[model samples]
Target: MPSLRIMPKVMTLTDAAAARVSALIAQKPGVKALKIGVKKGGCAGMEYTMTWAEEIGKFDEIIEEKGAVVLIDPAAMMYLLGTEMDYKTDKLSSQFVFNNPNQKSACGCGESVNLEPATPPGFAPAEA
Candidate 1:
């Protein structure tokens, strides 16, 4: 039988991240998920953007896990493949951090990152 789907593994989150997301969603009105994308800015050329997703877009990739929902922007999919999100809360700071395989470098403050497209298995370098 021919397969009809190619499910792309978007990303995952740590327990702390999931817990924080679930709590934040409870405070918002009619928000269904957290939408994640990348925008050009900061010292490293790109920064991650987060917004409340009231509704999923047609091309958005949805990932539901750990009691929370995350929507990946279509354009950011290629750069976010095989990534994991973690939340850290210390006496001085609290933030969500991305452990991305496609990231090439990050700024000193960690607010921005330089990203590269994730290459698929068996991909030829010559094609790039």
Candidate 2:
């Protein structure tokens, strides 16, 4: 059975971001979704990770918004709660940006983020 945890608190997405994700997914016929997570490696201890999902695994947390599917791993949910996914475009750069509430700080280059521990009323961190 699929895990039935409460729905995640997703951040707001700009119209451009929604459109960009839709277009990108359309370009890859074999990709059915996008996976979002964090990995330990960046200067600030954590880095955002995203990939195309060919299929939704049994343990994945599926969050759908604006016709896009965001697949998140259960282990990464604590660091990503209340995070917003946005698209930004400027004369020199363009990319998908993550605005995460649990972030304590980020590296100077903005490539790494340090996540604060989750403190929801009834939630606790899993033992390591």
Candidate 3:
């Protein structure tokens, strides 16, 4: 017998993002899911990172929706809360974009962002 447990979701994806991710998995050999996180660097001090995840790590938060699977780095859970990942293309270029409410500011080049951890809905922050 198996037990069912409801887990909290740490992130979400746009329809375009989900479809794009699904296609990437199909094209890559031996790929499992897409791994995403934030790293320190870039002009804004933090850069969002995405890569091909061949296996799930021990503490990665797994989100599966719209025929796609994403492995979110545990360390990035706070910073990425309430974020919607999307895919965009234009005549100039194409890329994946993060629409994040917790993002405090971004650099001029749009390559990095300084993010503040997201606050839960209906919760007010305490004042000093």
Predicted structure with the largest TM-score when compared to the true one: 1
Per-residue accuracy of model 1 over 1-128 as CA lDDT, tens digit each: 99796656979988899999999998999999999999999999999999999999999999888998899999999889999988998999999889999999999988999998787776654454
- Candidate 3 yields a Cα-based lDDT of 0.90
TM-score per model over all chains: 0.92, 0.85, 0.86
Deviation in Å, model 3, residue 70 alpha carbon = 0.7
- Each model's lDDT: 0.91, 0.82, 0.90
| lDDT tens per residue, model 3, 1-128 | 89986555677898999999999999999999999999998888899999999999999989998999999999999889888899999999989999988798999999999987766766576465
Model number with the top lDDT: 1
lDDT of 2 at 30: 91
Query: Once superposed on the true structure, which residue ranges of model 2 sit more than 4 Å away at CA?
Result: 1-12, 124-128
Q: Candidate 1: which stretches are off by over 4 Å?
A: 4-6, 125-128
Q: Looking at model 2, which ten-residue stretch has the lowest summed lDDT? A: 7-16
| Pairs of residues clashing in candidate 1 | none
